[model samples]
Target: MFKKKYLALVLLPLLLLLLAISFLGQAGATTSSKSSAPLAAGVQDIVDRGVLRVGVKQDLPNFGYRDPENMQYTGMEIEIAKKVAAELGVKIEFTPVTAQTRGALLDNGQLDMVIATFTITDERKELYNFTTPYYTDAVGFLVRKDSKIASNWEALDGMTIGVTQGSIQWGLLEEIAAEKGIHFNFRELGSNSEVVVALAARRVDAFSIDQSILSAFLGKSNQLLDIQYKPSEYGIVTKKSNTELANYLDQLVQNWNKDGSLQTIYNKFGLTPVTEISD
Candidate 1:
């Protein structure tokens, strides 16, 4: 009986030793798999399937627009999407998406990613992850060169202001005015271009948009005599569950900022570079 008990004790230790080795091996395998996982699963899936599905706007000028000459989508946002595809080693397939469908498309997996000029907001951050800022601009009050309305936020009170409907610019303008205890007569325009035309035709006293966009428009038309920008910035949008992809994009944006890629894009379209709005 004693001999049997001793043998059993020895064999029990051996069994435990083997079990420990097996656990260690399984842990190592798991670690290896994790380390070897693709950087962006969505991107990898698209690459493996031999296509990169991107959602882009067909009307936003300088961001995403179809070229009338060739009917090919092209712009700063398109260029950024191309860069991401090049990094992932995939062919890009763009699908026309408006602001309304952008979230749903990404949610349903119809689009791998969206490179549209999507503004990051706390409200949007609930459903989507936002990368580091790709471009920076602010809400600017655009008035005719000869208009006498106040250009600055504090200076304008009880004056009718115009902004594009469903835009951050419109929201920010209202928020800032409320915070400052100023009342603004606000008009929601159908589109950004319409806001500009309204300002030019004296339909509205002012128009609000990002500084870079406002600058580009004024630079092209030479119509802006007085422009005042209230500090803000832009960011890339992605689904919140896509944390890995979001981090990758944020890193890429930081690298791009460091390497002057952002500035280069701005310069290509004849706009001034912006740095360090929110940091």
Candidate 2:
């Protein structure tokens, strides 16, 4: 009976040790599983699909533009999109979008996000998620060098100013007009190129848009007015239901802003973003 009792004691400790070891192994596995789990649904979806579909502007140089000669997209926003895709370990597919088409594409589930020069506003915040501003710029006017218009906003008071259709510039101009108690005519076109064409054809007295964008179109024939107004901030846009993706993008932007990555991109493109304009 003593021998049996001794055997039981030894086996008991052995069984307990095995049980403890098994439990510890399971706990470690649980931690590993949790740590290796997939990302949020929105982000995981992009990864599973193997491609990040980003909407970017093809017309605006330096910010986002497609080279017809080489059939390639190049710009600051394009670089940003490439970085995002690399983070997700996916290839990037660029879809050319304008101010009018970007929102609709996002709503229709055709684009994962838009990196175009989309300005953030409270009203728009209700409709879609916007990351923190990546770039800021103020409104300016581009006019023919030979035009009699002075190098001031007030000079175009009564003249027709061409603006991109569906852009906020029209409303902004109206606000400025009201504040100054001056009336101005506006011609809304579909794209920046069209507005520039209108200005070249004298269909509009001035091409009014963001100064950063105007800098791309400046040449010997046209000059940007020495005025600025209503500084607007551009942000990455995602669908309203994809706050997870927006949050991720926001964090990336915050990091880039702090680490001077964005500044490096601006310098490569010779872009000087205007954060504020003096009255």
Candidate 3:
């Protein structure tokens, strides 16, 4: 009985050791398999799954709005994403997100990328990777030409302003107004079109949003209103770990600029193409 007990105790440790080695080997194999995948580092797993997950906003006109008649997404950024997906040889699965949640979606691995009309800023660069600017734009104000408010930035004082939620332009406009001693009340809207609707209804005195976006709205609505835009640039965004993908996109943008693809896209919408900077 003692011999039997001793034998069992000796075999138990060996069995456990074998199991530990087996687990370690499996872990090592998993790591190697992941490393050998075909997609970009940190992104192979997603590509291997055969879908490029994208976060886009359907609310923003001319950038990501969906076609009302067909319920298909057709906008400037959407076109750009489609091209990228083609190059990657993967299908695109778009996830709708608001300005407030876009960054969160990118960070959480829920999205492989974001090509929405996301403006690049110094602070945002810390949290995500930015492709080289594919387009330039600016924050601009929209007001009815017949309205009593001032036409330019200097003229806006004591007038209520309308801006969309989760827009950097909204916060910037408020600060500028406050600094200028302009007591403007800022109204938050869901989309740029809503902002224009509010202004037309006199629900708000003025609206501030991206200048190109405002241009698209004006072109479509043909409303009698004066429009203006200040200069800025826009870029694609990805999670910080997606450096390779971001760089790839930057290169693609460069090619687009050289071959007139970017200009062609802009021209299709009657938008003036901004010159690309080589640096």
Candidate 4:
């Protein structure tokens, strides 16, 4: 009887200890499950991948240009991209893009975002998500100094103008032509450098694009027309379904604007952003 009582006492404590350990193990598993809940799809995917793929212009100087000799990218947009990667704690991979290819790449899931001087428009907003404008600029024309083209929109009537393919400048100019009752012949080229070459070869009378972009091509042989028009706002672009990513980007832009970070970037590149233009 004493032996039976002693065994019962020992077995009772052992059973209690095992029950406590089982309860604690289940509790720990529950806590971990709650803490490991997945993030939103857009944010989670990027975090899981460990890299941020970005599309950037390879031609535009002081914005997203790549050096031919060293193959290094240095520009205001590049710096902004680096900031984004840093914020996400990921490495950045830049894919060369142009006005024509940026949207297509985003649509095909080849790029996580595009910072290639993408102009935001109502039509574009229907297709992809856009952050608030980080930079604003106006359209301008670059003409040969010796071409004797008057520095006004009216003077370009019936003359051939070179514009980048898929740029908004064509539609903007169309509207201006309709308003002024004048017409312009437009040559849509694949890239900015091609348009510049067309202008140099006199294949087109003028090369037109954002004033800041035109400034890069300006030289002793060419001059920017004295006229600027239709202020364009550039925004960071992401896939339409990535609303979470877009919101995050929008908040970053808003914070940067408020804190003068955007202006600091502009100053670093010697850029003076134009919000409005006087005719």
Candidate 5:
């Protein structure tokens, strides 16, 4: 009877130990899977797919645009996308997107990366990861060449301004004017092209967009009032879940800046890269 009791005590502790070990093993597995998920799933998918699908703009000139002559995509942003794909040893498939769809497409995995003048904002960072800024552009106006308004932000008071819908420029004028007591009427269009058209058709007094894009309309409209109201840095973006790829791409961008590859691309596109990796 004593032997039976001693055996029961020893085996009870051993069984409890076994059960604890089992629980701990399962917990460790769950942690490992959760922690390494992005690397294992998101990064692997890029490699298995053998192609990087990037969302870029089709209308913004000097950045991403379709060459009207040959209908081929070409610009500073396109070149940057190409360089990333080349480094990844993968083919690039460009998907044209507007300001409204760029974030959604990237988040949904319909597009692997986005380089369509994507600005990094804290709000957007919650949805995706962005590389170090490639350029720091500013918002500028495309106004009628003969307009009497001064070429500065102070001139925007009581003006009818046009902006692209879902663009970063939304609320920017009002936000900046918060301290200046400036107020203006807004005409929100669906796209940058539409905003330019609105400016030309006299539907809006001035069109607001990035200075890089405004440069393309210099022949038809006067560039005025470079505004830094909102962040204007352009960045390469990937899914928030795609941390590994974002890290890898950031390294590539840093190396490109160090080696002057970025300078060459900017010079080719007639753009002055205002920001750098160091900044």
Candidate 6:
């Protein structure tokens, strides 16, 4: 009987050891499988670093403009950046960039993404990956409320026009003017504020940019021409090779649409022409 008792005790420990070994083997397999699976490098990079660096505009109010009063970034795009960082479970560091530098910022890994009213285009796609667009921004002209070139091309044939460098309408405005035999001096500036300042100082008669930006200057300037010359879809821009991050952002946009969160964000800012994203 004493022998039986000793044997039982020994066997119980052996059985427990075997069970533990089996469980550990299964756990090891799971760990191995997960380790071997493809890692979302872009997302993982943000997670590992605990920060999501984003490129954004410094001017262009209502979209990505900064508050001069508090000197803090707070606009529709800024809010969107905040939401994206919150969703990614990380902190966001906003780097101010102009149209010319935004793509380059993302290309050199300086920014995880660009939410600076980046328009998705075929030419741009080869250089960057764009998530499903969150909104559509059209081309528009902003002339001073008292300017003579309010709407039409006539009566301002030789005036200077201001456009942001690297903006879709930058060269196109001049190109169209040349083609139409409406000669005008074209000034491509570094930022939207520069363009607006040029117009204010009479350095440029008209300022052309995205309509959403033109909306911000509503009371000060007349959006005389809301031409959808190039229907620009505002998309989140990422590195060309970072499709995984792009996909995640696409999914995030879809979910935002489904949950009405996107509309809420638009409503909070009292913005019109709120964009609806598709899956």
Candidate 4 is scored at a TM of 0.85
lDDT of 1 by residue, 239-261 (tens): 76877777877888899889988
Quote model 1's TM-score: 0.73
- Model 3, CA-based lDDT: 0.75
Q: CA shift at 128, candidate 6, in angstroms?
A: 0.6
lDDT for 31 in candidate 4 is 98
**Model 5: clashing residue pairs?**
none
Note the Cα lDDT for every prediction shown. 0.73, 0.90, 0.75, 0.90, 0.81, 0.79
Q: List the residue pairs that clash in candidate 3.
A: 137-232
Regions of model 2 farther than 4 Å from truth:
1-37
lDDT of 6 at 88: 73
Q: Who is ahead in lDDT, 1 or 3?
A: 3
Give the alpha carbon lDDT tens digit for every residue of 69-150 in model 3.
9878867788788888887788998888877788999988899888877888888899889888877876666677667554
Query: How many backbone clashes does every candidate have?
Result: 0, 0, 1, 0, 0, 0
The deviation in Å at residue 279 for candidate 3 is: 26
What TM-score would every model get versus the actual structure?
A: 0.73, 0.87, 0.74, 0.85, 0.79, 0.77
- What is the lDDT, from 0 to 100, of the residue 81 in candidate 1? 84
Q: Judged by TM-score relative to the true structure, which candidate is superior, 1 or 5?
A: 5
